[model samples]
Target chain A: MSTAVDTSAAVPLPAEGDGTPLKKRLRRAERRRNLLFGALILPLALVVLVAFIWPIGSLLTIGVDNPEIHDNLPRTLAVLEDWNGSAPPDEAAFRALADELAAAKGSPAIAAIAKRLNRENAGYRSLVMKTARKLPLDAAVPAREALVAIDAQWGELATWQAIHRAGGALTPFYLLAAIDRAIDADGDIVAAPEDERIYVDVLLRTFWMSLIVTVCCLALGFPVAYLMASLSTRHSNMLMIFVLLPFWTSVLVRVAAWIVLLQNEGLVNRLLMWLGLTDSPLQLLFNRFGVYVAMVHILLPFMVLPLYSVMKGISPVYMRAALSLGCPPFRSFWKIYFPQTLPGIGAGGLLVFIMCMGYYITPALLGGPKEQMLSYFIAFYTNQTINWGMAAALSAVLLAATLLLYMVYARYLGPTRVKYMKAR
Target chain B: MLQPYASPVERAWYFGMRGLVGLILAFLFLPILVIVPLSFNADSFLMYPMSGFSLRWYEEFATSPAWRQALMNSLIVSPLATLLAMVLGTLASIGLVRADFPGKALLTAVLISPMVVPVVVIGVAMYIFFAPLGLTGSYTGLVLAHAILGVPFVVTTVTATLQGFDFNLVRAASSLGANPVTTFFRVTLPMVAPGIISGGLFAFATSFDEVVVTLFLASPEQATLPRQMFAGIRENISPTIAAVATILIVLSTLMLMTLEWLRRRAERMRGARR
Candidate 1:
């Protein structure tokens, strides 16, 4: 703001600076205006950069973060740095482990290191805890035999291997495991054991479930959008409330409503029983079928809105001319109308698919545990297990997939249309 | 999409497509409307074949301390978050529209990234990021998180409004010896007020409906209505949640109507000027 800005006289006055030339003052004024606007933008820009983007960038790196072991067990890892993977390190490495565990015995770092090692090999938590609990070994006695005397696991090759594997300042453990792979005791990457090989399947299932929902949305949304676009503005506006109402409604409310409607004794089952479609109330809720129904219902509007806009922009003249030239109706519709709506289909499908890949609440509520998506697992790790690294690893994958799909959608819709107004 | 010609197949197809569209529309409306009656059901179970009509569920929502607290939390958090989002979003959008910069596209993408990023990712990110700062489970954290989520909508809407704005008016006022601040207050704000209000409404609705982040961030003491409803849906499907959903449905309807009215009024104003 300038001192001259307070004036509201009818006639224009000279520029503010007295000595300087008018041209230079005008240039200075332009610079000041630029600075003012930049100042106006700075607060929100700084807030987003610090509070949003930086945090997310740091979080994604947490997938590979290995601070716990690196900070806590620095001596043991340093001793083992020169050792080969096939066999255990010698007495000095054992001495370092003993000293480090003794120092970190009662601190939270021991528990953290123990947790980190336990991921390398099961039962290592209790081994490390027991050794840490009985630490500060006698200097006269050899560290190897003394540790072996404390816990028989210290004599085993696997214990040393687990310690060696977890000693890195930054490890690919969580990120690798997110895709159902892990480093073996011998420091070779291998497929996770059959029982632990769940995340890859989970990732695939997330994609598969998202694909099914996207296809279902297109199938259901196509006719609705077509009709809505084809209708008069008055009728279309009335129909719009149907789409927008559910669109604006909270996902939780819709989930609750779907549960009330699809539960065993609920309306869908009751109607099915009354109509003799089934002999009994079907197992609807907490099943894949219910998840599909609810997800399609919730996501139908996303598909419809974009498709409706695209279809509305398509003139009827093209199809009419094709038909007027003696082309069959179905052929004309397929060759002309369908091709024109391809961009809409791509945009809506990508948008819906991207959304479905990250869906948590609906599937967690309506579907069984087996049917939950990647987001469900991310939440499970964060809330139930408090495994931030694992959660972040899963998040990194989902975030990448989501951003990649968004880029594709943006390519289809262009930059300005990237604004998705779907309520969180 | 029908022709007045000549075959049973075409007629069947015409009726079939229309009927399919009708059923799809009904499908969209059914889940939303079905819960309204259950909110008033006297029975404990959330099922069909209502036993009786009663306002007990609504009464429960009105009286239960948890429900009351959640409603209060929603009412308090959303408006504050909306106000913050509106102010910051209005300022950033004005700056964006008024200035030219080399990194403008990058800045916009960064700003709008919150919308495209999944809520679960944002929720987890907020949890981990806020926990050490003692912001998780606090009102300040929740409000900031929600305000961030709302900024993109405000930017998009305000930017749209500013697109049709006449810059010559500002120049005219300034040349008449009015200061920039006076010109802005006397000319620009009144014109863009509608866009700000609509965007603020969106921000409010978003914060009111948000639950995923709250589940990670909010304590029981800070639970909003959607968080409470999520817990109800997870633990048990009860009539009380139905009542809450009904109220939320009504609220969303009112919001939609307001947005529609705003859209029409903006259109009418522009039409009048034209």
Candidate 2:
């Protein structure tokens, strides 16, 4: 550190070269600043990478990575590398398959391994298990014949193709499963079973339900948000607490409270019956109506806050000015006030809709089987089935859709997104 | 002239709207209020018109080993997550606000990703990523997972607060022979303390209420309060749950009041400084 200061003393003899010494000193200082800032950024970057980025990246990979076939049978994977879906994998490949399956027979990891291959062909596990025990054959012909002999299931080239394809740690199996498709032997993708085909429909339903909920929130929240914005700061702050109080409570508690309020035998029902509005209690809980009601209730404030904040900055004089110029109150509001607040509307709607799409517990508890969202299936695949590939694939679709929505918003409503995001 | 004090039409409309809003707000608070009274129910079912009032359910919650364990688990995890979030979030917030760099906007989005991503996705991702490392179902894993979820609140609150901070004080400290570390602790940290504390409260609230990630990450021995409640809901909708709910509502309301008070104090202090 002293050397840096001493260098200035040593260089004082030169006149024309004084700028060079100063520039060198300046560069050194800049370097120190850069290093210090770099040091500060490194840990944050690492934490984000380790805790967030890496997990999502792995999730994306987990959707496709079929490590069981590759890692468990390295020898066979090496053999099948050059085979290229042309002929039956040679005797060594069959032997390797048999050896690995036999090794994985009793382990819990087998379920995961079985799940990976099952995507390609229905009931591929029995074929794989049957072939495994009859292996270590003398020649290629006998090995291939034995695989065929195992319930005549392995004779179909598609089963072997999926198994061979799954050798890589990364595969499109999960992503395909997300959309109810899987790669066949000929590399053709097809729809899953009618029962399994419901996932794509669920994905669409999730989108539509979220959209409806977002729209409902905007409609209901607009007036309240306007009142908050139009009022004095103290009144607005008090009202804002009403909006924010729910946010402080547990989402689970709020949802549960809604169940108690909205159930058939609950408060709403009892009140309706007492008022003679209905003869019998309505089927409210564990249905789509309950889902929408609770979701909108829970999400309405998210819609209001951004709109309120943006509206606060907007003056009402424009509307009054327009009204005085012969425009009616309604027209003035539509043409002047509403357009100015479009940014808030877009921001809040996007935020709420995106959030509603990924909701799990609310839908899981309140919604019927038909109303269960895509997130429900993602959890099912990940937790209940141990099917990482399918979970990853579903999440990838979700991520892609979200990113796409963000991009579209940025392109069309750039300033508003920026504003709302900045305010947050 | 027979001038009426109020026109019936106008009077009805005014009262109607105000009454509706009042009803809606009351509706929002109904179950919360109901749970409090129901916690003292002598009968077990969560039906309307309680038979009698008693403290048996509250006693059950207090005496039951499982409920006590769950409350204890929440007590342990929430504070640890909050502290971790406070340190990491405050440090990152300083860097985020102090330095202008390329990709800062992207960095902000990345930092907040945990809040936006589906907890199911996070749960599964953590499960897969940590399973290989044997961190799954461990206290450290749950702590880290909850902290990840909590960090965004800290980041958000602290960042917002820092936006209002005067940077000249830090620069002045630097000019007066204070290095970056000393300047931060001596000048900047004190200024952002309120933000950090409020952020920590939010972090604590987020973790204490968190269930999805905890569901995926925890084993039976480590089940959190929400997880326990979730299981109990599936098993039976007992009055004991109502007791727990009442307790949780009380705790949450206190937390929210504290948060509001802290916010008001912060505003007053800022106004005074100005």
Top-scoring candidate (DockQ): 1
lDDT of 1 by residue, B53-111 (tens): 99999999999999999999998888998999999998888788866678998898888
- In terms of TM-score, the best-performing candidate is 1
Question: Weakest 10 consecutive residues, lDDT, candidate 2 chain B?
Answer: B21-30
Locate the minimum summed-lDDT window of 10 residues in model 2 chain A: A415-424
Q: Which CAPRI quality tier does the interface of model 1 achieve? A: medium
Which residue pairs clash within candidate 1?
Answer: none
lDDT of 1 by residue, A1-424 (tens): 2212222221233456677787876666666565666667888999898878977888898998898778987888888888886777799989988998899988898899888888888888898888887889999999999999998889888887777767778888889899999888777899988887899989999999999999999999999999899889999999899899998888888888888788788888888988999998899988899999999999999899889989999999999899899999999999999999988898889888988988888898899988999999999999999888999999999999988888877765764334445545
Model 1: residues >4 Å from true position, as ranges? A1-31, A79-94, A141-162, A415-420, B1-14, B176-182
**Residue A76 in candidate 2 has what lDDT?**
70
Q: Write the per-residue lDDT of candidate 2 for residues A1-424, one digit (tens) a residue.
A: 1122222323444355556686777656555544444355566667778977898898888776767767766777777787768666677776666666666766755665675576556687666555555544445456556666665655666666777777777776667767887666676787766677776788899999999999988887887777667667887787766766666666767776776677677888999999999999999988889999888877877787778878988887887799799996667889999999988898888878877878888888788898888788888988888766777888888877776776565566553323122100
Cα miss at A165, model 1 (Å)?
3.3
> What interface RMSD do all candidates show, one decimal each?
2.6, 5.3
